[model samples]
Target: MRTHNQRDAPGLRDSPSEVNGKGTSGPEPNKRRGIRGKIINALSPISVGKAKIKHKKKNEEREESKPITVDQIRELIHEKKLFEAGQHLLMMEKASYAEQSKEGKGAARSEIEAAYGLLKQEALRVIKTSVRMAPVNPELLQNTVRAIAEQVKEDKTAALEKANVLSVRPRLWKEAWKEMIQESVTERMQVPPFDGVEGLSATAHSFLHMGKAMKDDLITVVQHIKPHYPNDFRVCCVYAECYYQCFSSQLEGIAQFELGSGDNALLLTWVQNIYPNEIKKHRVLEKELEEANLGTLLPLKQIKHLEETYLINELESLKRCLARCLQMEVTRWTQGREPEKLDGHFHSELSIDAIQAVYGGQKRAKDITPDLGKQIAPLLLVELLTFLQSYKKELERFLKDNKQRQHFEATVIANINNCLSFRTHTEENTMPGQNAVKHQISVVLHEIQNAGFEVLLQGLFQELQALFKKFTQKTWLSCSSIMNEIIGCASNHMATLRTLKEPFRQAIVEKIHLHLVREHIARLVKKKVSLRSAEQQGQLSQVIQTNAATLHAFCTENGSNARWLEPVLPRLAEIIRLQHTDAIMVEVGGLASQYPDISKKHLAAILYFKGNLSTSETRGILSVLDIHLSATLPPTSLFSDIKLS
Candidate 1:
């Protein structure tokens, strides 16, 4: 043992020189034992203390590595550290899945649901703002969608694992978000100063505006907000569904109400026409909207009711309109007002108005009342036929007293001109009742046309009556100026009638030709000129031939299109000029074949003009014409209209 100062000196206590000295021997046993014991005593407390500190650090590390608690999750969420909160949520779900305690699992499930619910609430608020086209921070929308995606993952995992704990938690948040989409649409759509669709045209116009505005809002969704959503959202389809439901509800309101024809038509127009057109008008929207597969705006049963109701009502309304137009026309006729002409042809607004009424309704009908044009056409035509018959009877009644009226001929001509408009439109048609109506209508128009011609011809013949009586007399030469004078009077009448349209213009020319031929033949049948000499017969034949030539020239120049009747007068003159009865019989056969309506009296007149023939000869000549008289007379017959003495 050394002194205290020497002993306390750090270098002297464990001197490296003394320990490393080669001559140094081991310390005595007692001394070494004492030093060892002292060393063990000093290090014992330090070893124990260090072992406790190592165990305590391990406990702290374990505490740091464990997942966050529910409280801590809430704090992170409140701090807007959603990423860390989401990690905590997943860990909580996994731990809840592993937990065997029902009570503890239930508590964890509740907290997880509560946390997800808060997230969904925030997400929905952003979605609503975005769907409504309100400006929002992009990050909020991104975060919202990310949360939903995670929830979707949880939903899928729960489904795959059949997770009993996750079952207790609210799930299918994606589906819930879809429901929110519908709710958003409903909320946006209900806002309105709604229009009343109680009237006819007003209802259609109002609905069109509504559909257009809705489409515009949806397009705004596609442009501004849909990008923030995932493709699985199918935002377009959901938007379309909500819009369809809203529109369908409004239409149901219309279907439940009692409607008139016009009102029903307007409703159907919106349902079938304007609505479909509006949804498809935007190409971008069309593809998405069709995918939604929204059915018609109204039920089929309701649509059928509206259609039938509209049809029946429209029929009655058009009938009333037609009756009114007819009455107005009759009133005009009674007042002696001439029906108007267009482009030198008679034209009536009644036909236009009649067709327009049906077509206008058909145009508005869209798909409702299929083939409305075909269905409604017959009604108008039948009504018109009835009115025309009544008109013709009224004209016939007026015609008897027409001579006293100053404007009778002009008014009749105007009415005749107007008939063309009706006839041209009312021809062989495919509409119901078209054939029967056309037949009756044609008869009535024909009678009116004939009466009109008689009126026109009556005036023309008056000037030429004295000249016609001079024909077939002894002074009447082969080329008499009387025929020229008659033709001249006819020419003057033709000039006055030139304003008539084609077919009518040619018709009048043909009528004059037939009348002249009939009158010329009538003179020969008078039996005044008995040509006992062949020379007199020859002279009369020459005169007849020359007059026939002159009449034909005048007719063809004035646009007479009657080609078959051209040879009648020339052939008759040939029979007179022929001397042999055999040749004349053959000639008479040809003439009879040409004019099937040639009668026995007409043959006798021709035989009497060539008076040298014996009675047997006359009998023989008439026998050749017998076969033609019993045959059917054509619609256009010349000799049947002639009077035989």
Candidate 2:
């Protein structure tokens, strides 16, 4: 009727309030429309498009006032509904942004900006917590990573579609997430808990525990986080690098501390024995880490410096241990305790302890690196050599005052065995200075053996000297008591001499034989004996021959294998007893051929004792050496040491 027709009336151009004097009739207007009018509106294309556009406009206007807020973003992110939050953020940004030619919706655009900012901050925190905290939430990480990807996509869309009206540019939140790994690892490694393991220092335990924690986390990355991430991320290597850097820094800090030998050894064990062998080369992590191309956790130079420090510390500790062992051994000896016996041989623990201390430290060093072992063995060998010298010196001092002690010879024998044991062990090892060290040890052994022999035969020299002063005189030639007394004095020392082992036993006994024989010859030199006739010479030669035979028999019987000494006295007796110059010349030539070291003083003594050879004959006898002995003496050093004067 008039209602529908009047709405489209040509003169209805006025404002609604003024044009509608029938405004109160609007409720009645719907009732006036019929089925025919509704059908026409629904079927008409223009009216359909207009109605759809009007409906969409009304919904958007309502939504624009309170489109996705910062609080909503915070709640979704907190709930870890990251994909959903990212979707809603995209929608809100698209809604708030104006077209490419116009500025974005003012307050709504600002809200979108705040929401994304909150997202970036929370997402970074999530990444960090995933690394730093335990029991990683895989789903949360997956969602966060996905959401970051979505943000990247949305930012690209925003830049391309609404370039001029862009509210916030791309942040590339994933890169920020990766960077968080370093900061996360640093904080986590700084405070690893004590593992309560036995025999490890706090620093060492910390290192071990942190390393384990890192490995465990990296395993998580390999199994869970890495598989979920795309290949381009190389998430495993990324995690590994962060852990390595943090753990390496921690190692650097631990290395700087003033550590004990045990601590250093433990550190060496971890750095060398465990880190490279067990961790980096682990079964599961090996291939991945190799591809990752992370070099050794420590640089070569840093590791080298650490190895040197550990070696020096170990050597110092070994030196201190040797000194302490020597001190304890001295106390045991001073207390007069019979040295502990092993296998019917006198024994002491000093050598055993010293060997163990040095090689044990060497083993510890080598455990860190073979190069470290090379550095330490020679240094330790030197320390042991020095200890041996100290050992000899101390024993010498002790022997002077304690010769009467019942355990004295036992102590000396035990120490000699100690040196032998040490030398044997030293030679067995292949080290830089092993041969030289062994030689030095042998020298110490020789000195110690002489020291003991000197103590055992202490006062016999004075007695023998007194009696030998009467040599070549009337009373001495008649009496056999002088030689018998010398034999008796020497025989008393032979009891202890048999207790030592072969080489040393024979060496000591020969030293005694040399002492007696040398004294016999030295007495001749001192007396300047020149027998005038055959009867006196025969008497002197007979007495010397009898005494020399007795001495040789005794010396050979009691481990003195010095047959060279045997011929020395017998030949001297033959030379002295001879009256003919040719026979004497033959003997002198034989002696010179056997002992090239026989000097002019020795020939003078022998010739003067013969009393048969004229001065020219003596000169000719000495001339045998010009051809037999060169300016460079032979290596046989026996007679040069005889001291004929």
Candidate 3:
């Protein structure tokens, strides 16, 4: 039989029966003999050749298992095969781990680890080089960062430190910051609404915490990144939003109070303090944005849209606050509560504090330092008009039922007179309440003119006619008092009354003229004057002259009504001169002679009146006047004897 070492080698082995029968003792002797045989075989040339072949194969396998070369990694990176490059790095790490685990291979393991480290650094260098060549390739930087992060997970602290440094790059920092904001926004949206007061308080606290956290993050990012991209719109927006969120949280907490109750004062105070600061902050940001030339990074249209949105939100919130305050004050006034002190003055019914607050807002609006003021001015004006309108209705209803209407009317007239006398306040520091009151009066006058001044004038004209119908000293005095009040009010607000001046003057003139005409006709009917008598004609002419002189005196005394009436005084005089057909014909002849260019319509207007002459008689008078007037004209003229009929 072959020796055990030779038997075990080259597929040779001991027989099964001999192996079983030998058991423990037999195996010990066989093991010693096999060791000697194995030594002899290892020294033999054939065994040595086999061992060399095996060792060579093992070396080849080890070489095959080695990490990917720097050249291969560079090729992958160059081809944009970032995933493959990452995989190669992972494999290198695993190979390093394997080498470290092997027994008695400490030196080789250390060498492999060093090679891996160098390859990793080289891979990162290649990635960074690629990025430098094409710095806009965000994918390259992202992949490289992710690979390094993964490889260095065991040393997370170092990895994080490295990441923080890497984020200093503008593109990298912007992307990271944007992602952070987006995540916060998404998380905020997903937060469920709370139910009760306690729940709401909890929610508010949570929002406050979140706002603080975000603000801190924003501060950190901006401190690090602003130097590189000072004009970056997104970064600037983040900074703005951070402040906005903090303020909003505080506002939201304040908003939890019932605004319609005793908390209104607190709410108003908070709003008054916050709104101006918010506007100032916005203005400063706007200036900085301009200085940074941020318009290039952010399109003008988008920036404008964002700014408008922000301003609109702020204005809307402010408007709500103001409206709530006004409503609360109105409620208080309606309930007969003592009025709040406004500018050291207590008003009984007027919500003077609310008015001052609104006026303050208007002054801010007029300043135009904040561009939102332009948009807000109109809204505030609407609110003021609405407030005035409601007050006017209340006053009308009060006067309708109250026994002291005369006293109220006298007080209002006196106030108006006082206001009119002072063209402007002598003191530079006019009280805001006083200014607001003046502005309120002005707006009220303007609105009255716009809404229904004509209607009011028409009603007054009718009232004057009714008073003239029952001509007595008491009635005339009453009419005069009404006229004085109306005229005084109009004169006090002349700028606002300018538009209705002509209509007002016309109404007055027509009313006075109608009175004069009715009186003249009544006198004639009373005298029963027969135009056939020269004496009666003289008497009628005298009546006409007296009435005309009275009208002239009335118009002259009332200068406001004289503007339109003076131009028509001659026509009135001519009308008054004609009491019968012959007199009308003669008067028309005199008018035509006085005005050589007078037309037939002019003669008819001068002669015509409602019950003065029959149609045939009037036609005959016009025909006779035309003939008489035309007879004086030159033959070449168009009017010379042109068919007087």
lDDT of 1 by residue, 397-423 (tens): 777775666555556666667677677
What digit string (tens of lDDT, one per residue) describes model 2 on residues 1-645?
579778677433433643454564343322223566467545676766999999999999988766666677769977878778888988777656644346545766677678777777777787788753324577788887788778766567657876464646666666777778778877767765665656666877787677887777787777767755667677888888888888777777777776776776777677776777777888878877887776666667767776777777777888789899999998999886887768767788988888888779777777777877788878877887898889888998888778788788789888776766776777776565477777887788778877876765666677767877766556647658877777787788777666676677788788777777777767665545678788887877787788889888888888787777667777877887888888887887788777777777887776776666678888887777677433333334667766743
Model 3 segments beyond 4 Å from truth?
1-98, 104-216, 225-397, 400-406, 411-573, 579-645
Model 2, backbone clash pairs (residues 3+ apart or across chains), number: 0
Collision count for each candidate, in order: 0, 0, 1
TM-score of each model, in listed order: 0.76, 0.64, 0.34
| Candidate 2 clash pair list | none
Tens-place lDDT per residue, model 3, 1-645, is 889887668434454544456544333323223566577545676766999999999999999877567567657756656556656755654455456546765554454445444545544453324312223455554555455444444344434566433221121323443444444443432335555545335445444344444344434334433333324235546544534455554555555544332233223322332233333234434443333232121234543443344445445555665567546533543343333333332223233344555556655544423454455555555555555565455444443453233333322222122221122221232333445654665666444333333333344445544533443323321334443443343334333222223444344344444434333233222322224444433443454454445555654454434333332335435444555667667665664554454455544543433245567886876675456454343212222212222
Model 2, residue 132: C-alpha shift (Å): 11
| Highest lDDT against the true fold, candidate | 2
2 against 3, candidate with superior lDDT: 2
Cα lDDT, all candidates: 0.71, 0.74, 0.44
Candidate 3, 236: how far from true, in Å?
A: 11
Worst 10 residues of 2 by lDDT: 24-33
What TM-score would candidate 1 get against the native? Answer: 0.76
Q: How accurate locally is residue 123 in candidate 3, as Cα lDDT from 0 to 100?
A: 43
TM-score pick, better of 2 and 3: 2
Off by over 4 Å in 1: 1-115, 129-131, 134-146, 187-191, 194-202, 217-232, 276-282, 327-341, 345-348, 361-370, 390-411, 427-434, 462-466, 628-635
Residue pair clashes in candidate 1: none
